[model samples]
Target: GCFWHHHDCYLFKVPATRTAFWLDKIAKNVARDRRDIGRLAEQGWRVLVVWECALRGRKKLNDDELGERLEEWICGGGPCAQIDTQGIGVLDVTSPPYRM
Candidate 1:
């Protein structure tokens, strides 16, 4: 989940051992995700990134709320968006120190 994707959320944590390897691997995963999203978007495919934090956590949204959000985004016809513990919307992927 968030760990492999290197999401800046509560669920992601760099391993104490082999920290360098984990970080490198996670970084590569993040890069690949970005690249894949870009490719899909270029092909006119809508991309929705529902972060794990939004599904399970103290701040997780209820089923109805989550469903409503998904419905809105799907019907709204947005190119790309993300749902996290903070809320549902597009995040600045280019920004450093990414957060949910």
Candidate 2:
């Protein structure tokens, strides 16, 4: 979820206590995800990230909508894509570099 992945979304909030520790842990997870995605792309694998918010929140798409969106992505052919409550778009693999 966004909380664990530290996604910049409505669901993620740094904890009031042990803030630094939580931030560090989340940062590591984010880094690992980026690394893995990068490696897969390097090996010629297309990736699609469907964030939880897209499925469970107030702004979620209906089943048929989500299905059609996924189908389009699968057929359209792209290096990477992301689907969230905000809608579908190319995955932003770029950001300020993360340190391990």
Using lDDT as the measure, the top candidate is 1
lDDT for each residue of candidate 2 in 1-100, tens digit (9 for 90 to 100): 8788766677778999999999899888888888888999999999888877778877777898888879988999488888777667887667622211
- TM for every model, in the order presented, reads 0.88, 0.89
**lDDT (Cα) of model 2:** 0.78
Question: Measured by TM-score, how close is model 1 to the native structure?
Answer: 0.88
Q: Which regions in candidate 2 have their CA more than 4 angstroms from the true location? A: 96-100
lDDT of 1 by residue, 1-100 (tens): 7788877888888899999999888888887888888888889998898888889978787898889889988899478888877778874456523443
Lowest lDDT 10-residue stretch of candidate 1: 91-100
Error of 1 at 36 (Å): 0.3
lDDT per model vs. reference: 0.79, 0.78
